[model samples]
Target: MKPRFTALLTLLVVALLGGCASQPPLRQAKDVDLARYMGTWYVIGHVPYFAEKGDVATADEYRLKPDGDIAVTYHYRKGFDAPEKTWAGKAWLPDPADTAHWKVQLVWPLRSDYVIVDLAPDYRSVLIGLPSRKLMWIMARERQLPAAEYQRLLAVAKAEGFPVDQVRKVPQRCEDLGQAGFEQP
Candidate 1:
């Protein structure tokens, strides 16, 4: 009877864990004009991660390289006078079928999902997320998003099963950078 009980408990645990797994076949934007999408995007909000916690004035710059790959640079400041942190990497479309889908390789042998799940018609804003819906970023062309627009984006994220409560606003004060030289592509 003890053995049978142990077997039942094992099955129950497996079932419970399975339910916590992410839903499959994650959706991505239908199509993306990589050219229009390439530019400086201020990180207005994001699902907090260890590396980005307490970060402010965060932004991402994307450049289309001659080889068709994208050069990515992430910038952020930990505090008011903290030295800025930068991470440079490359991203590419592994599947030619989907330009909206990209894999970013910031560290060797480890590629992260860079799916464009939602994008503004004029390319002013975009919602990037991973398949697991565990990580997400709400990026925009400028520093701030209107309250209504932000709410709409949050609703869209919630529909996608993201833990919206984990989303935190990122500080973006270009003046803190002491330079307004970055140009949009």
Candidate 2:
């Protein structure tokens, strides 16, 4: 009886693990010029994590370091009058063959996948996705994206198997920027 129970438990564990790992591998952009990709990008929309929920005027700044790693700074405010928040991190190419696929280390020893799934020809907009397709961010060079462009990005994300309805738009009010001392890009 004991042996039978142990075998059943092992089978259950294997099943659970397989289910958790069933997500398809994310596809990354064919070629990304890391130099052109570096700069400030406004977060127009995202499937928010706990830390970024309710955040407004969200933006990410990237700088290429001498060591080849990318320095990252995430900036946002909770509300129009709320205090500004900033989180610093670093990103590096895990596979030398693919510059579009990166591992972002926001905290020590805890890295997350940062794949560039889509990029505009002019480098004015980008769509970033995770391997699980659970997290996504649509960012643009300007603080606000045109309505048509915004909808187009949403469609692309939806087609990629992401929950597009859950993607909340980040508020980029002029008043919010004036207080934060950020000029329009």
lDDT of 1 at 123: 89
What's the CA error at residue 117 for candidate 1, in Å?
Answer: 0.6
Error of 1 at 156 (Å): 0.8
The superposed Cα distance between candidate 1 and the true structure at residue 75, in angstroms, equals 0.7
Lowest lDDT 10-mer window, candidate 1?
Answer: 176-185
How do the residues 50-74 of candidate 1 rate in per-residue lDDT, one tens digit apiece?
4565678889999999999999988
**Global lDDT of model 1:** 0.74
Question: Best candidate per lDDT, number?
Answer: 2
**Steric clash count of candidate 1:** 0
